[model samples]
Target: MRQPLFVTALAATAIALAAAANLPEPSADIKAAVAASTRTPANLARDQYRHPAETLSFFGVKPTDTVVEIWPGGGWYTEILAPLTKGKGTYYAASPWPDGNKGVQNKQTADAATYGHVKFAAFPWAEGQPKVPDGTADVVLTFRNVHNWRMGYQRGGTDYSGEAFAQMFAMLKPGGTLGIVDHRLPESASDDREKSSGYIKVSTIRRLAEAAGFEFVGASEINANAKDTADWPKGVWTLPPSLSQKDVDREKYVAIGESDRMTLRFRKPR
Candidate 1:
């Protein structure tokens, strides 16, 4: 009986120590900033787009690094990133056109006002190619936007997907991370399917990153939705949020929620 009691006490002590190790040091200022910014309905909805804690954690963001969020649409992550790095880190939003034509500029402007330190840089697709300085960014992130480049919208006769990956690879310092999240296509699908379905095979993304000089670290299923059949008639846009087939089967699509996304982490070789 005494042996069992001793073992139990030891286990409890170990558990307590582990919990203490994992707890982040609370910052009252960060909490206050997040509270102030998320008061609006728009900000609230944007935060709901993904699991904030999980997404930010996956990026390995701390309060003392220079992080760049590529194509930060409506500044969804911007809302979280600004406060997470409020006092110490720098957050830069890179995009094309400062004219606010594609909603990029507007989001950047709004984030700048709220975050104060959030900066913006022009990375126009029409400029032929992106050129980010080497060993500059500590963390480069792009969420659910790779499919747009795959579709060749404004890629300017270049494989924008490949070019974007290369640019990210170049921008990161040795040992820096590149976090990507995108709607996943069925593994059996081909590259051609991306044009129609707005999804790309996970393997294809891995290969692209590897080709662009990144080491594929691993992937997460944190945002995986097993219910998605990957057979929507209108592609991923047929699902919730975008709901391209609004009048046809709005309820069915709404029930489906968002597409299953592949969460990937890649590292620039040190």
Candidate 2:
């Protein structure tokens, strides 16, 4: 009787192990690329807002999927993605530096060399439509960049942000995923706060994406910062990096760290 019970328990453990093994793992090449890039101890200490392995997994990034990163500023995430998709999958960075912004263009050029298979596509924020092919990308990722569109930062008069969301939906294949991460403001917060604080109410973001014909899947609090009271006079930049109030409230700002972020996942209608 004891032997029979032990055998059953062993079989259950085997089944669990099998399931775990089937789970997707991040590429080692990607990890090495990130390690070799501009990511440093000081950068991690201040701009270490990334949620590591989980963020990639949530986006359903695999070694076999074509991925496009939108507005890959300074190639921060691009460093990890370019090599991951090398050889097996295509990794494309859309949008060159705007108006001869050499600082950003130089960064992209330096980072592009790390992977031989990587490609670049121009993404200009003009009045017309985006040029990304329809139903082409398996994943489209934009980080901390949506508010600019909402506030017409890219260009005046046109709400290119909503148009950008629609373009992403068009660029993704059926059942493909859209991953977004942005600074989060309180739900009760007003539009004035969004313009001033560099943070947007989560509901507004969700509404805009849904309006673009994508399905609202879910969100994660992996990057939540509890210390932020959401009442900094200078807004999100009042925290680290920007530290808008450097002289007046340096100590208070340093203690809060980065702004609270909202991580959201949306899916193109299949």
lDDT of 2 by residue, 44-146 (tens): 3432456544467656777678998887766667656765776778887776334422434565566555555666665643445344577899998888888
Please give each candidate's TM-score: 0.79, 0.79
lDDT score at residue 23, model 1, on the 0-100 scale = 28
lDDT at 182, model 1: 90
lDDT against true structure, model 2: 0.69
**TM-score computed on alpha carbons, candidate 1:** 0.79
Error of 2 at 17 (Å): 21
How far off is residue 116 in model 1, in Å? 2.3
RMSD of model 1, in Å? 9.2
